[model samples]
Target: MDTVVQERLSTKIQKAVRKTMKYIVDEHDVRARRFLPRNDLESILNKKRLEQLFRELLSNEYASDTATAIPTGSDTGSAEGHDSSIEIDSAVDTCVKATIGTGNVSRRALLALFLYQPHTRLLSLYVEWLTSGHPRIRKPSYDDHEIPCDKSIPFTEGDLETLNIPFTNHGYIMDYQTIFTPMTIRKFTHHDFKTRDRLPFLGAKEKIKDGSSGTVYKTNIAPGHWEFKTSDGRFLPENPDTSMVVALKIFKTIEGPWGTRDAKEVETDFNIERELLDSLRKRNISHRMIMLHWGSFSVRDADGIPSYHALIFELATFSLEAFLKDEECYRIFTDKSPVLAGLVDIVEALHCLHEHLGFFHLDIKPENILVFVEPESVHSGSNHEEGRKLIWKLSDFGLAREKGSTRERTGHRLSSSYYSSQPSTLPATRPAGLYQAPEIQSSSSSQAGPGSDVWSMGCVILMVLASIIEGPEGVTDLSSKLEVFFLNAAGKQKLFYVRNDSHSW
Candidate 1:
């Protein structure tokens, strides 16, 4: 038994090392996007390895299952096969002679192994079993306790405190949860700008020509895109066509031309937003919404009040509105194209933002849903009816929030009907032109939770569906038509209660 376990351990680690190496080598490809973080694989693995111990989880059956999921023609629904981790028989440890360090070599060394031998699966399993729902069997009499939080667990107030996270209840859930969040994110107390310059990395990275955010640029990251942000009056990144390129988002210090009251609030909000995105990505929550890639802050002029924050993120194409518009003019393949697949992508992203990520995407317009119509993205949109895998990425986290990250100063002037959360944020008025939410009279960015964003998304969906129905032979030019339809739709009383806020807004 000891020999078998040891062999299993060696095989698992060896496989893990090789698997990690593969991702490291081919780090830029999309399919190579594993759940593990590229920069700190060993640490994440060591923390999550325990969930594999009592089952075939560490075995190739698990990893290959997700990657090479063979679809059985039958509709049994268990296409993943009846063989799941839960079905594995418990390996009762009857005591082995001269065992070679199995099971975190006893939980005492778990934390040490997590930091030191980060690639060590043994420690990861120990931590997970103690916290996850797998339910660690404690006594031979079947007294099973789901590894609830205790003193030695991986999650606790101690961990949150260690992480420097504030505002929490307890337990070691992700930072978004009450488990508490550490503050590695930046707080731009000082508003200053550096020299203006074009980011060299943007030119070197692969360019993504997705109209809305402008051409998306990607770099060789640990299986992700490295984005940069800019504020050239365009919500999109400033590309090589302009001097500053690179990163996902950039903030111009000047608060438009008119409203500059809570400029500090605006700068702080943006900085916190960018920093929060980076922090979330670190937690490895890849449900659907955009996570952070990389970020930096710099100023161009000598005495610019608010500096330029350059950010870089994974590449994605045009917005939903843009896609619909383009489809309206130029035929984007058949109706059975990856377009339908985008529906699933959209809902999945919505669900994650609302339910899992514990935040709201206040700006959930069609433009927010980035599309990737590249050749590789679609196996064959023409003939491959079921092979429409246009991977949609949710980007622009300028308005995302954790469960309780809304207390900061936001620059939004609210109307009367705005929710409490929305009104509380300091008013950072929008442009005089842009259309406001129906209930919102003035240019107010009342921070709605995920539900509010859902209201916006619901509006987008109705407009798209309306276009498809009203158009001649289905709305072919989705990209071009989306914005016009939405702007028009916003004015109309399209906000159905079901589609609108269900939560206490």
Candidate 2:
């Protein structure tokens, strides 16, 4: 190869190696921070050793290049050959000295090099050094040693070995399921409620509301005796009979041939909701905005196929729709301050879902906005509504989709009843709700995106603002005036919206 061309190729290869090293270092840094003590992790990624290793690697590369380039046979003993070898060695030494002297190689770069080439003999030496009882490398365990022995530190090497974790050829555990199971199990065991076989015993559920997709029921849970830390960093004992209520949402199941196909579809939707909620839980998103998912369970039919799917969530006081209809609660919204504050809260929740989590809650409506009243106010029957705290949370994510995902069509209502009547040409029927965006109304339009969710939220905010400004009577009057009647395929009058010249609602 031409000298210049070879040099260019080598430079590109070096750049690629450095980039890969950086990525590997970043990935391991994140994982190590979660499971390993900071001091121990820093020791494991020793900077001095990394710099030495990098210098040796560079020297070896240059030495190999010189060996391949030098003349073979009797010419190897010539003065010309000896001079060429000395010059190559001199250049390689200069480059190595410059790399170390300039402090160009960082600890991360060194760690990356080791991680990127784990099969290299150097990595085995590094591992041996790590296990040689270095003072900085403390034994893997939780920071606090005063805790009970039964409360084992999670994800330790011992624990991983006990679980018989499978490791890759590179000596790294790649089985995320086995690694995360311990944490998941710990979370469930330490949760506020106890369960039997991973299924919480929700006693005698009362139907709260009926929807096309499923029904929600309010039920009490058998509370566990787990102690939890409060916001101010104080541990508090949980009351076993403090009336811990939860919401149980059961997905609707069908029967027969068509129903059998529909059952699978229902299961798919149930899994989507569960997975989304689980994602939120794993990310530790604010429970004040997004409802906390406790657990999920399914019932199988005689053929051993799943028939009924249910999810357990933290119960809210009431839906925003129901709250507005209540004479007492409606009065609270009459004050513009509370209404504006509530709107901000809901908007922040939507922002978290859309921007932070990259999820679009396609079904945003007043009914899906759950309201949680302060427990003290609820029990004390406080007449001072202004002092009461109302937490607004976004719920009912059965129709939610991840941003940029187009594998499945959006806006399909979870109800089995609507499936038979759905038009074949359209991707899916728009959910039966007044808050649907304009793009969703047209059959030929593309799948609903993040903007669709914003539109629905805007509609909800509009209704909420109108209720606060004009009271319940004003909202009712406004709805009556905007109601447009149109004939459907069955020649029945259906309430719809007609766009004006400017395309405004």
Candidate 3:
């Protein structure tokens, strides 16, 4: 019996090691003429990212399993499943921490190994067992314990005080929740852009975009003088009143019993946005960005459960798509020079994003670009320079990622199709974009770098130019009519440039 147990343990360890290595290599250099001299594999694998990957794997594992899901409401469903999920989460967390503590392999190294081949059946089964929600053996004797509630959950005033998060019981979604802490709270300060008081303590007036994860609201912030409780418990007034409004983005929280199941994924998406915003801020590249987040706040639902999240951002007058649809602006965008000038501004912003910030706005359609029409144009109905003198900023960082990320990511993350005809409906199998780069469809590797952005930009410029020259109907028809011709011509031009000049496309 002892020998059998030992043999099983040894086999498991060997299998783990093999899976890790295979995932890391991922067979990227399968066509190498000879073995590469230098392979710095660790460059891609780092401790922080490795830990993140582990958390993701664990979250996915939990999400995929049906048994461990929490009950939907307070009155209905089984507490056993919720308890089981909690147990599994705790166990997995402990296991991962212990594994990382061992330091036999770096987190990045382990991640690379897993990514190379993914996990095999036997190893996956082993992991499933190791991270299972409950024991296979059911207890013959079980006792019922009272289900925990808001009052039952012991939280001290000192706890909130220690965190320095004010809880006015102001009926906000995030204030009442015991477990959650908004990611943006860590990034910004109280007085930063005067966002602390500017955020509304009340409910949203109207919802703008309702997505799978959350809703965007067209709400008003205080923009006026307000007082807040300081760490020393002093109520201090900051700034004078100004009537300024902002866009408030709110996320749905997992509520009832089953809510925790989906909340993790929602929180993950929210955190990604927060981290991206933090990166932008750290790089000091917020000037031309579409939306700048001031801070994050939590909102409480009717049940007084802190489930909803809100992020404050500068409100745009309108989207570029809206601008294009306006009959007043058609004359200005119709011309090449001013439209090209606007494109130059966009390019400058893109340069700041890609070159300086090392990020790519993966989803770069007209709707994602917001236009702040010049205040001077408020009264003027002029069709030339004044009409075109608008500022464009890129918004919606939901699908954005750092440059040179792996191409393993497969999804159509665009907001909505601008054209009436679907690109997916077209005969040729291509990426879901009229604005998508040519290489994104052709390249097997996942590196959609600055080049992809440039390609998308070219498409956007063409769309605006086409709309100017051909009209709105022409904008839709432009790609289908001329795509093949341009592609063929561009291919020839690429060869010509490569042959004649030192440059390569």
Candidate 4:
């Protein structure tokens, strides 16, 4: 396990135990008309005992033979040939025996065991077990035992000024207010922007894009529900009623012929992206050409384990590739000048990244160039046009590195076999060979720098120009003509590049 993950899990467990114990003591006070001393409760419900009990329940519930773990209220069906109720009862019985012992257990201990349903994820099973008339303790009302959401922490004015984040009604800064603490993602649906496929089933995540490092999804955050206090202690969005849609990028474990990339490497990638974004935020560099990173949070699995670390970002209407391919959008860009201007905006953004920040966005391509179309313009016909307003921004910095970093370019490529196994409809996981600089294509090269990024940008420009002049089909034809293929040492037909026979562009 990654150290970060271990720390988060330990913290969550400790918090859960404390909350359960608190609930038990509160219930005891209500019943006996007298408060129990902290030491008395400690004798029955120490952190270690409750922590072990919760862990045992988690292990039993998530066992391979058991029903699905962490029943998120959606999966009510049981596993085939498995009686989950029986398993739950047995696990609960063993936990009660081991933690409380067979002797006369105190009412506080019974309440403590009963109140653990929410923490251990046993939910109704724990309630049902308690109802079997073991000494007839009165069942607590649902409202009495349910855990409340964490209260939003107000940001001191000094804190905001120190971080250089401004107080503004601008959508980007407003969205930033919702992310100071990691907000829990309750439900989200994924949409694949490239294929534009509607999900077959409802309530499923619409996967916008999948890459070698992570997957991105579109999700909504309720403004007031996730609102933050300002420097003066008032919530930024006084209204806080509306919902804002944002992009959720979740980092995943990468497996290839090289070997399986572990959680630590994935965590490192997550941290690098966060640090880069934070640097941009602290400098108050909210450029229109750069995607706004709201914040980052972790997603827990059924067993309450932090399965994936995710970042929140401003969601764009489309990618550059998707925009050019859509017939309606192509018609909107008929003037060609605006298309060229958008490309220039991207260039300026790259300049900010490379020159201002001293960072290299090694993985620059069409798919990473996000296009934000005004909502009003999306439905407008070509005849009604003041022309569609488009904002292009650079995104997906998983392969980015600082100017002089010594880290190897492990993310540059995947095994040929791994690449081949991906779905045909999905966009290329990384920059296609046609867009890669010669240095990136050469396995012998040690590193790619700013010039390499410029080379990639030039390739993007050619594709954009081709789309404006010849449309999507013309871009396809240009790609086929420029593409040169070769086999790697593994006898796999893997390499793709645009250089001529003499190795010169």
Top candidate when judged by TM-score against the true structure: 4
Compared with the true structure, what per-residue lDDT tens digits does model 2 show for residues 1-505?
Answer: 1133223323433343232222234565333212211122234334454344434443344354454554555665476567644654444343233223333222232233334323344333333222233232222332222211112322356554543334442244332211211111112222221111122232345799865456898864433322345679754434343435668798766443223326667777677777767777777555468765666766664355765677777788889887765667776644567557877998998888867776777788889999887744343344566566778889888777664444342226322111213212223355335787665654454345667678888888777877776667766766676654443432322123564322334
- Candidate 2 vs candidate 4: the lDDT winner is 4
What's model 1's TM-score? 0.42
Instruction: Give the alpha carbon lDDT tens digit for every residue of 1-505 in model 1.
Output: 1123334544544343334234244544222222222222233334224333323333432443355555676555363455443323332121111011343343322222232323234332433343233333332231123322222333556654543334332222332121111111122222233333212221134444332112344543332212233445322222313233233454444443444434466456556666667666655466754544544554545466554444555455556666666643234444534555666677787777656655555556666677665555546434653343456666666655555453443554322223435433323244221112443323444333445565566666665675555543344443234332223244422233322322332
- Local distance difference test values of all predictions, in order: 0.41, 0.51, 0.46, 0.52
Q: Cα lDDT of model 4 overall?
A: 0.52
> How many pairs in model 1 have backbone atoms within 3 A of each other, for residues 3 or more apart or on separate chains, i.e. clashes?
64
lDDT by residue for model 3 (162-203), tens: 323245421221222221111112224322222111122222
Candidate order by TM-score, decreasing, is 4, 2, 3, 1
Give stretches of model 4 more than 4 Å off: 1-202, 228-239, 256-259, 284-286, 300-305, 375-382, 406-432, 485-505
**How many collisions between residues are there in candidate 2?**
0
If both were scored by TM-score, which would come out higher, candidate 1 or candidate 4?
A: 4
> What 10-residue stretch in candidate 2 is worst by lDDT?
177-186
Candidate 3 residues lying further than 4 Å off, grouped into runs, are: 1-204, 210-214, 223-243, 253-261, 284-290, 300-306, 331-338, 376-388, 403-431, 438-447, 479-505
TM agreement with the true structure for every prediction: 0.42, 0.51, 0.45, 0.53
Candidate 4 residue-pair clash tally: 7
